[model samples]
Target: LHLPAPTDPLLRALHDILRTDPADNRSLDDHGRRIGASARTLSRRLRDDLGLTYPQWRTQIRLHHALILLADGTPVTTVAHHCGWSSASTFIDVFRRTFGHTPGTRPTT
Candidate 1:
């Protein structure tokens, strides 16, 4: 995803929310409300600014958090829960797709 820098107020706010709380699984509607935009407008702005839809962007950010948790020796189940995955299986599937390996293959530090 070719994301633009967080220059817009809405983008900056969204970045802050994602950075401070990757566990936040708010829908596009909820996020738009926080930024004073309709979901449609929010979608356009996100695509224009970030080159991805809300859900796609959220997944990317959540996976980033998942990686950090995994690197810190957190259990996969706990990491899945913390990252707001519906189930460990789902989390593993996403992790595998993104990283080309299952969470169990993560190197212990």
Candidate 2:
């Protein structure tokens, strides 16, 4: 698979982490410091390279986790907690915005 050769050591380190399955929990702040880059640098790279900010990417990851939980008959409360939402209502709002339907209103079994 072709991948961009990173321009800096900091970015190269982050690129390796990015290569891993994103579902694996990773903290951008910690990764940034480990590679001698600031959190802002990491955020910029995430947006410039991946077209998303770190938080946005993380939120998307959590939302995907929520979908899996919901599909597997997990309770909405459990899903929200596990997916890192502050509350079920917030999770449902994001869920609806992203998927165009609320969790309880989905057609899936």
lDDT of 1 at 79: 94
TM-score of each: 0.86, 0.68
Per-residue lDDT of candidate 1, residues 1-109 (tens digit): 2334555678778877886788888887888799788889878888887788888888887888887888899999999999888899999998888777799895455
The parts of candidate 1 lying over 4 Å away from their true place are 1-5, 106-109
Quote the lDDT for 25 in model 1: 83
Query: Candidate 2 lDDT (Cα, whole model)?
Result: 0.71
lDDT of candidates 1 onward, in order = 0.81, 0.71
Worst 10 residues of 2 by lDDT: 1-10
Candidate 2 Cα misplacement greater than 4 A, ranges: 1-31, 34-36, 107-109
Pairs clashing within candidate 1: none
